[model samples]
Target: MTPRDGARISGHQYGAGGELCLEYRPDNWEPQFTGAMMIGSAYRLLSGESPSDGEVADVASAHRQTVAQEVRNTKLRLILNTTLLDILVEQPLLQAQPFTLDEHWFAKHWLAHPRRLGSPDAPPIWAAAPPLTEPRTREGFAIRLPDETNVPFEGSYAFLNTILTALNFAPALERMTASDAEMPLLLVHRGTARLYSLAQGTGSRAVYVYRTIVAPANEQRLSAEHGVLADQCVAIVGCGSVGSKIAATLTRAGVGTLVLVDGDLLLPGNLVRNELDWRAVGLNKPDALAARLDDINPSTKTIVRRLLLGGQESSASTDSALQQIGQCDLIIDATADAQIFNLCGSVACAERKPLIWAEVFAGGIGGMIARSRPDLDPPPYAARRQILRWCDDNGIPWTGGDGEQYSLQIDAEKPPLIADDADVSVIAAHAGRMAIDLLKGGATTFPNSAYAIGMAREWIFAAPFDTYPIDLVPEGQWGPDADENARDELGGLLREFFPKAEEAADEG
Candidate 1:
């Protein structure tokens, strides 16, 4: 029947609740409107009547027989299709058909090697004698039987099956005996059939077939020698968009233990970038983030804290938070609060844990990522000082805002500052990569590094500033008093990092 007719009949049968339907057409491999053909044929065979027109009598019995025959034919086609797929998987030769010289050599070596076909301990398949050889007009040589004086075709079953299966032959495995002379002949006669079939089959339609099938094998092999072990504990200090993304990436990359800390509840504003949704609103950010992370990678150990750091509430003190930070191998500062960032950095340094501090500047126009590790010769404090100096030298401003406050300069001629959102994601991702690289021992070339990304300029500068180390002592050699001296040192550092812009004439 025509495709349209088949579709109409299928819809009618499905709507009527018929069983044994055929929902797809094998010709183009598209789904039919419904599986009416199978359903109608099954009904006709059983009831001795025409399912569509409801015709009756002597002719109906004949119709039932015809319907039964059609059913058997359809079943056979399905079985053949399935069988082809199975054969290809079972036989390596079939799976790797259309063999290159390298492939043929490897296969011959593997088949002849004194190893098991199914087990490492099993005996070789061709251990009886050395492989036989036969020359081809264009293809190449095929393995020959030692005892047989006569050579089989060059692209014989042994050679062609491997190529076809590897190329596109479904039911990857095919059974052939000495009696199937045609099987051996078909290989040389139709060398391009398998290749043509592959071009027409699933290979042509796949989005990333090579990556989907081949990349994993390569990744696994490389990972065996270079894969990072997920043994270290990672502490994430916030569960906002940046924090949640970091946590998810870590878990997916096989982090062993993850400690998530955030006091805020999930809100509608958070959904714009957070991993969670409306259902998570009012729930603790850490807990919600942790739950979603667990779903993504169950092997990761997730610990949740529902309290903000450096706040006046319970368990908010620096000492209490430092206790938790001590257990982690690395700490990430993703909170927008400056107090929390300072607190995390201090605790991490005291405990010798590496810290990653990330911030977005200029409403998102620019961002900075800083990495601080105790083992490095120059700690992150030096890098922080350099960044601060760079900001000052570049005349970058920092206007204070309440609750995760950042200073913004409305005029372009003003100092470059952390005043926008453009910097947040860039800094966060950069810091996350730096942290991973550090943990993997891949950052030996550069230590105490900071990367700044400018969105408007589309620029990325690594290690953009010279280091100026600053001590973290409560009382400094710079002054007799502790708190006041510390404030003065910081304020002076800020002013030095961001000098006032010189006056210029208006061109307009």
Candidate 2:
């Protein structure tokens, strides 16, 4: 009977009102739906057309951004949520197969990787390894997502007994009756990204626990596995409200290296938009944000420098500061300081590196998320000037809004443009997502762009997603290239300024 009386799971069958269950095709390999495989599946779904590196990244990014609900009474996310599993099954290889790991082999691998975390549920009985040298394979089934399983998960011991007998391991099954370990029964379902395991009741009836499999923390092969941020070197300027939030986001996304620059101590006001709490009020901005970042992701190497960019005139500290900016794979100017942004933008353009600069308008009326690709996008300084002009022509206030109480610009002497932390956080989250997307493009030829998202509650800024175009200045003078020799061991300049970077470098 094909699931007529009870749910059918692989070779097992259960009566009605049993625990949630799942099954696999006879020949599918577990753990094959990796990042590269997911990318392949997403590409195929995009119409059999071969995709560029950027295109594969674009599709897989959505999966990374998906939300998962909490696991049974835990902070960890459920790995095999119906929505996520649907996407995972997109890859052809994820189609169910007739395959099962040897019992000993499964036990060995499980024991090798100690349960660092998660539910400790296990099975009451054990099965011996199958001696079959060749596992069977089948085809002709149409591709589809796995059927939804019942909630309050469980498995059956009779199923394991059948498996043991069929594989000529009946003696082992008898020994399991005498064994004391109550480990949960684990199954490697065919064509699924997850392992299926359950704790069984030791009685005549089939009862089990709700324990389920989980995603390994070390799965960082691609954006699908680690949200496309596994190997990024990101340097962020200004670890204040906006900068601090963006830094936290980048770290959580698995950025490999992070440089946080902000010289000032965390003021009491910073707690509003800042991810940090009041305990960190006295700490330097970079230090506070760095510690917070470490807590978010210890693997993310964090280097905090206590020097405000553009806050100081030309000096050795400034030179070192510039070098710090020069050394990263990508530079994010979260600093609202106009002078520093222009300086950093020029250097990034000259070096052909990516630069993402974002800022919130006063009173959180709106904010801009702008990014430039070397040789492809406009210089950040040039782009910012054009954006400012656009805002001016559009009647965006530099200081106060209707009645002069709201602000749109952040001049050093003016009142705060975005006074509310919620407003700052709204823009910061948007900018953070954009930054991740830029990195996923992987050095592709995407255009330079500025994105503005307005908060409608303020009524002054009502636009949803407004795109502002910046004039392409092909001949702008960018600063020194961090790649080419710039400093000596003694911190003295070794090379003179080279303004002809455009002519010297390849446009591609």
Candidate 3:
């Protein structure tokens, strides 16, 4: 329709004031919400560094900022949410606050840097947008509710118009008359709790609600059908390269609860491979990883054990750590430590909890994921044995004899060189999917208990490397049934860590 048809059209993607407005019928979303915050923050990625004393903040700044501009034409989108206030009908900004544009505050905070601006001071920075949280725009949401692709528009204008007036937003609506916008609008359907969206459209006053990420439609259907993910609990013993990504993968699959156990602190070197962010340096790996997971999927509950398995000297309570492992539905051994790996396998077997161990082969040559649960037809540790056997069968070099393998570590002392970050991520995805399937009771077909991915194996063999691919011999495999001598070698180091550990060993 033309502008003369009584509808004002604005910009194709953004608004007249650099705002990207969206509306969500909280009930219309896949993972529905009740309320959100529309407080504007700098549109940012990776939450970049803020402006220094006199320097200007980049378009994609991180966290909160305290500066307001009547005209932000240079760049930046103003965002808002229902987070601070729940009711759409009540807004403090609507109570009649005149524009207090202080030139000094604006100049100081505008392109703040040490050369000119001394330090931070108060600056009014508020704008309006729809309340959207934990947005994942790059990825589509897996689920959307109501299943109606076309929203009815027969009689929405009067109610929308009335609500805008009652909420004191009529002024903005009137201004919208002059420009076209691609805005997402959310509203309560028929005054009911259900949310409906007046999605993407080409009018100055239209509200379009879009999300960064949502649950996949198929997965949502499967969730309603079986919900195997919702009922299971997994324990990730490491938050390192393979482990952290595996944790994220399971979360994406709708796993309800995760127990993270790791005592190490995030190192700067870890940024290249692990999921830890720049903000997580020196923090406990499990705790940092847990926070990241919560930000991604609030529905997943994480319990962190920031104690080392060094046994008694570990910062975590020994009893509590063991109890956490004992209680989990499955144990994921991602630590790759002989001590941690053996310990997890032993405990999982003893407790009869399921176990999945995944590791990236030296370099990006390939990787392996081994699964074992109560469903195994063989004896204890069979799952572990099978995965190793599969690795050997596939020509995976687990022995150090194949020369120094590529590793994720930059340390010279650490051998088994490492794979590139991308290759490791590929393996993590393979392992995560297998883990989820095993949790689904293994009725579905899998490549075998021990799954391997050599997608880039040929590339590895092609590269002039220091190592050669060798079979994963029995000695290279660490499973529950391994000789007691191997267990004691590692267990001895941790025994002094916990009194109970020594006692249990003696008793056993």
My TM-score estimates for the predictions, one after another, are 0.47, 0.49, 0.52
**What lDDT does model 1 reach?**
0.48
CA RMSD of each candidate after superposition: 20.6, 18.6, 18.2
Top of the candidates by TM-score: 3
Model 1 compared with the native: what TM-score? Answer: 0.47
* Worst-scoring 10-residue span by lDDT in model 1: 206-215
What tens-digit string does per-residue lDDT give for candidate 3 at 1-508? 1133443222221333433222321123454433332212122211233335544343421223233432344221222133211332232222322121111123222211001101124332332221123332210001111333233433254444444455555533553343332222333222111121233333323432222111122233345423777777899987888889999988877788999988778888678888778989989899899888886667788999877764334444755686788688888888666556666766775577777777766656666666665534232244455545554665644542232332223356555436768877887887787787777764756635554556443533443232333222233223343434545644564554466866887999
Number of colliding residue pairs in each model: 48, 18, 60
Off by over 4 Å in 1: 7-227, 315-318, 375-382, 396-424, 442-448, 458-508
Ranking by TM-score: 3, 2, 1
**Top model number, lDDT:** 2
Tell me model 2's lDDT, rounded to 2 decimals: 0.54
The CA lDDT of each predicted structure is 0.48, 0.54, 0.52
Worst 10 residues of 2 by lDDT: 111-120
List ranges where model 2 is wrong by over 4 Å.
1-222, 225-228, 312-314, 395-414, 442-448, 457-460, 463-508
Error of 2 at 295 (Å): 1.2
Instruction: List, residue by residue over 383-431, the lDDT tens digit for candidate 2.
Output: 6666676666776445435221221123556544445778778878877
